[model samples]
Target: MELSVVTGCLAGAISQDPEDVIQGGDVLNKQASASMEGFLQANAPPETEVLGGPCEESSWIRPPVDFLKCNWDASIDGRSKKMGMGLVFRDSSGGFRAAAISNIPYITDPEIAESIAARWVVSMCAKLGFQSVVFERDALVVVNSLLSPSPCWRICGGIVEDTRRMLHQFNSWTVKHARRSANQVAYFLAKHALSLVQDIVWRGECPSFL
Candidate 1:
């Protein structure tokens, strides 16, 4: 399957024809992974920590689920820099809900941040124990890919799937595209995450500080 995907990418890039696109089922389809890898690598944000290490859940501190909004952000590690992703969730009244910020190993490009953000949202949402909530993000590619009919990129597809699993936890939920200005909370959180040199700290009034 990877071979097929890579072929597809090779076809698209090497084509001498101006009006050319990778034909459906073309052997070039195999190149998708290779192309996507390079694309992801080239487009990835700057460098950051490689997450997915063992994480600890703090029962002491807690997020206010009923706070009215939720936001999530993640950074994609580029070769030497990191690209960031931010998401905000707001209730019908448009107040605070929940917010998250995370960083993952560098890949290559910005678009990959979408999937990382998507997966991070799911993981964070689950941890947050949000029963019913709306999801929002600044990455159109992530949102559009989720909404798109074409099968999402298989690797990124897992992030979408994980997001779907988290969605099941919400009695009511929606994913919406939001402008950067509207997603300030999550963006701050993501950017703030970059400040930590040895540990992660949460600001605002989280009960966990208790």
Candidate 2:
């Protein structure tokens, strides 16, 4: 589907409550804030943890010599109904090639949020004229959905199909699941995006914070 059509579908899917739609943005904001706390609590990391430099003894694996590894993740801000997406690209030698952080409308469902992130990954990579890329995400549902041949009937099915189409445009690509710890860079970037006013893309370097 075209970008405009896909965007329209996404918007329609996100605005499911007629009451919220009629009540105005205030009601939507209240609803988002009420649910967001639970969502974040459910997804929070363990209290005891080792903090180290990026990729230090991390499970994040490198791709083949000629392939680029792209780690992608998404975070949500319920009050604003915004989703932050992050992607970090690295070569086989673990050298950062590029990174991106974007803020977009939040999809309440975690699976949908992940599916959107995957779609964004492929779309951005295609636009950058990349090939032989390896995609890593912490969301196994999304990885399984993408790797499955059977038609997806989930709410995010259309977005998943769009992602598959974009992936086919690449000379080669693979999607796999990674532990959250292994995807810390992308995860942090995603959280940071929640505070960003505009999307940021860095080529040939990574954000100083990372």
Which regions in candidate 1 have their CA more than 4 angstroms from the true location? 1-67, 75-98, 148-150, 198-210
Instruction: Note the Cα lDDT for every prediction shown.
Output: 0.42, 0.64
Best by TM-score: 2
- Candidate 1 lDDT at 82 equals 46
- Quote each prediction's TM-score: 0.53, 0.71
For each predicted model, how many residue pairs clash, with residues at least 3 apart or on different chains? 47, 0
Residue pairs clashing, model 2? none
Residue-level lDDT tens digits of model 2 in 1-210: 000011112121222211122222344334433433433454112332211112222497878898898888887666567677778899999998877767676554566777888888887787666777888777667677777778889888999888776677766677777777788788766765565444556677444445
Error of 2 at 106 (Å): 4.7
lDDT of 1 by residue, 1-210 (tens): 000001111110112221133122323223322432344344112331111211122211122344334545555433335444334445545444443333443433555556766766655565556555445555555656654546556666766655555555555554555555555556555543332221122223221211
State in Å the error of residue 42, model 2. 18
